[model samples]
Target: MNDILIQNTTAFFEKSFGSVPQKVVLSPGRINIIGEHIDYNDGYVLPAAIDKIICFAFEKNDSKKSKIIAIDLNEEFEIDLTQEVKLSKVVWTNYIRGVIKQLQDNGFSFEGFNCVFSSNIPVGSGLSSSAALECGMIYGIKELFNLDIQKLDISLLGQKAEHWVGINCGIMDQFSSVHGLENKVIKLDCNTLEYEYHNADFKDYSLILMDSNVKHSLFTSEYNTRRIECEEGLAIIKAEFPEIKSFRDCSEEQVLNLKNKMSEKVFSRVHFVVKEINRVVKACEALDQGNIEVLGQLLFETHYGLSQEYEVSCEELDMLVNTAKDDDAIIGSRLMGGGFGGCTINLIKKGHENDIKSKFSNLYLDTFGIELKFYDVKISNGTTLL
Candidate 1:
């Protein structure tokens, strides 16, 4: 599949630019297994890069302008390296422009270059395709210019670029995109930026994502509102418990005790974060012990919390989880990513992958009248030159 993507991208670049690219980079999309909405609370998250990736083919240009083509979108844009980086009216070009703007903000100058890019990651499916694009472009730029920026810094730059584009995303996506390891899940401390790799050998199970194919309109607004509610709850809690920092440090009992002081909405938001943080720790332990059952249970618990408490899960996502609940071959399934509507990560028995996908696809189409999309994903190394 990767070979096909490479050949197609190379062919596109040669056809578009009239020459082969001098450098090629591959940046992968990511999947968050158990943790959700906790990254912004300075909590822990478990995410891994998947095999689906975005590829960038580039070559330095003699002129002072950078030409970029979005192979998938069949769109093209030009940027003057000498001019100040600004937002593009074209939405897709904004990501690339944001990266250039971020690098410029950090005292790095970019040379004019020609880039052709393509992605296999499904859009709006919670796979972090934007992060892949941002990271791949910056990493390629780092190599093309012989810059000394580290991988971690590149992730940060990518994240900043997203922020510039008005997403207000956490570092998890970019971090996983840059530092992902094959067959491993990264336990990241969102507050301290500390991480440790845990072996994710699913033995006889495979990691798969079922896209709900319905993105709710409330995703962006509700996401910001959730963040605000968390802050409001924290402020009320901090006044009473000076020692408590984030939801990570606050216990369930602590929040329960202060439950009367905050609104139900704020309480639910804080409660989900505190509980989800602990679940991530337990999920990591389950992975380390190779206990797939325990991990599966945790995934179900996470979906419930996100649905009832965090209020991020919609009918399509909940239905996807519910549809697989009775299947013994399916161990764990939950709504992954920022939620309102996206993919649900599932741990399914290896041999039953196709059967489960087929059953779920038919059920989803019957229920929602929307076709479901499935991706049989494996953990893969992060961004790389190919």
Candidate 2:
């Protein structure tokens, strides 16, 4: 599948520049299996790179100017590496430009490059397509110029680029996109930058993502607000329990004991973060034991916490979960992203995938007049030079 994408991108690059690209890079989008908003709280998250990816074909040019063709969007742009980099009105270019900016800031110098890229990762579906693009560009540049940058550094540069674009995202997306392994999901401790790969072989079950097809503008502001709430909750907890460093350090009992001292909203936010941290630990155990059913149950519980306690889920997201809960084929379902409106990751019995997808699609359209989009994803390796 990725080979086809690379071939197509290479063809496009050659036709656009009249030369074959010297390097081809494939960077995958990621899915968070169980954790949600906890990444910002320095909590653990279980995420894996999916088969969907952005393919890049590029080669260094003689000039100091860089030219890029976005094959998917039918857009093209050029940048002068010697001059100051500025944000572009074209959103996609900002990601590439941001990567260049971060690389320059890190004291890496190189000539400009001409490239063409295409992606199958669904945009606005909360799959981290931007991270794939940024990481792909960074990795491609590193290979093209023979820069001494490690995989982890590539992930960090991609993250810094996103932050430059004003998204303030965490390392999970970029890390998983660059460090994923086949048939494994990474258990990442966001605070410590430590990770462990856990087997994600769902023997007879398939991983499916059902898109809500609605991305609210409220996601950005609301995400920032959630972070503020968590900080406030942490500050309140820290004042009394000075030993506590983050939500990771707090137990359910300790949080409950501080409930009366904090506002209702803050307390609820703190409760979700602390509880979700524990859920990730248990989910890892379930995966180690090869218990998909228990893992599914943990997914459902995480969704509930995101919806009720974290206040991130919307009516459409809740409706999707409710619909899936009625069917035995779907062992678990939940809204999987920043959560105003996005896809719900489901663990469905292999043979019943189509039936469950059909059922969810019809019911969702009937209820909200919007069709649901489904993606059958596989666990695959992270970004790499092909």
Candidate 3:
């Protein structure tokens, strides 16, 4: 543990519970390089954990009451295990409340716990900060109570918790937080929960995340509507070809054969899903063959699809990707999150890190009148006890 975080958390716990925590857990946020909005379609995704993470210091309390203090946010939230809390509000307590409800629903015995939560990850930046917090909570509770559940099981449970909290998200966020490996990207099969890690070697390059500073409050509603469109597309395709399981199970020819049956809007949605899946496959091959240039071009093409076909890219994201493309040292850049506004994940030459940062920052400010936040990240290990 970092000495400052431990010392502050110790003081807070001592003041609140009269004792220090018995265990601490860390869960990291993840960034997807290319594939987006495909997790629910049972498609492929390449994601890895970054250095930014959420940390929790916790102890089992003797009294049957749960108290949580967010050290960084300087807010306190408490809930009693005996009482049921409704989930309509967007308060900070919703996250903890969701976990408690899901655990109770799963028939797990609950007792009082005192926890101090803090994170270095930025909220609403499309970096999976919410999932990191939930993953850390689940890990801390399991370890503190000697629960032997598998990590993937924990992920599913976490997903249910998020669903109850009113955020209709897919499994990608929680899955990455629980299973991310160091120096590698996990290719997730959203349907089977089966995954394979590919060693992505960029000897001369670095991964940079550029925050657009625009919040995605409408992301939830937009996400659900897009998912429904995808299901509609699937419904049309399945009516003709019952053997096709998901968009993942369909081919270009299969989709083209049923083109007339799909509404134009539904067709556009399916077009992106099918092509994004193929992009993920080809991107994986490019990484395997040590062809960073090919992977870079795939990222560019993916951004264009997102900006046009998926209709998720915003002005800030488009500006960032376009600025990145103008630079010769930058290999690739694309929006990293669900929709309207978030960070752009970029692959750039390591030696030009400062140059890339300065150029993008200046361009973003001149164009959008907003400063850009950049993170030079590496693939790091996932959740663990600290």
Candidate 4:
């Protein structure tokens, strides 16, 4: 816990609401160590909560109305808990509103509350601050109301909240934020929701995010399109291969054997999903065997697939990964998240963090004339009361 930040948020809550908050929660942003776009394709992802976080302060009010404030945004929302929770015109509030609605829709009743939140997670750097916000609110509410909600259910409710807010996000983000453990990454089965934690001991290597700081307009629209494309390719394959349930059950060979029938685009999508799925499996094993080099190589392979086969990587993202590939100090690097311009997750020699950051930042500006940002993050525990 950062005492100063938490103390500030709590003080602001007291000044705004005229009383001390009953609960304060720390919800963390998450990073996928290896897996990326394969989450929606029934693939396993290795994600962990990071030190970056959203701190929420919650207090029950005597009345049936709720008041919420976004300390950083300088925004406040007021709503009657007994009435329908309509989608707010304010976009950020919708994430919180959706969480309240999820709880209310599921028959969990609680008193109206006042909340004040502030986040340290960079919004568009692909660290999943939205998930942190949603999960943090839900976890805080659970604590405040003393609700019978397990961590798994907290994650599910967070996912539903996101869907309610109109993002068709997979479970990886919420699960990682809700269930994260210190110095560990989760091997999450998106299909069954079963997961296992592996030690994330980078040893001499450090994990860094090189933010390209560019999000092409193609990101949101193409994200939905990719899901549809995966479904289209899978429906065709599953029709011929009766036993296949998802890409998890299917193989690279099967996807190849039917390549002639599939459209070139669909085939590429499926092939990437299949190969990426297997890559995650090997990645877990590599970590288990303490073969950081093998895991690093797998990161490079995943980037190639995301760029060439998945078609999600933009030029800036590709450059980030490609540059890391050539650097001897860097073991593995790949574009993280849905791509089309976000940060590339890089594993690099510990002593070289400064030099690499300087080299990459300068190179990026010279090549694209856009300022680059980088984050040094560490694995941390999931959402919990402060």
> How would you encode candidate 3's per-residue C-alpha lDDT over 118-223 as one tens digit per residue?
7878888899998898888888888888877689978888888888888788899999999988889989988888899999787678888899999756677888
Preferred candidate (TM-score higher): 1 or 3: 1
Model 2 C-alpha lDDT per residue in residues 1-386, reported as the tens digit of each score? 77788889999988888998899999999999987888889999999999999999989888999999999889999999999999988888999999999999999989989999999999989899999999999999999999999999999999999999989888889999999998999999999999999999897789999999998888999898999999999999999999999889999999999999999999999999999999999999999998999988888998899999999899999999988888899898888978889899999998998888888889999999998999999999999988
Error of 2 at 80 (Å): 0.9
Q: How close is candidate 3 to the true structure, as a TM-score?
A: 0.96
Clash totals for all candidate models: 0, 0, 0, 0
Model 4, residue 330: C-alpha shift (Å) = 0.7
Cα deviation of 47, candidate 2, in Å: 0.6
Q: Estimated TM-score per prediction?
A: 0.98, 0.98, 0.96, 0.98
lDDT per residue as tens, model 1, 34-152: 78998888999999999999999999998889999998898899998889888877998999999999998899866899999999999999999999999999999998888889999
| RMSD versus native structure for model 2 | 0.9
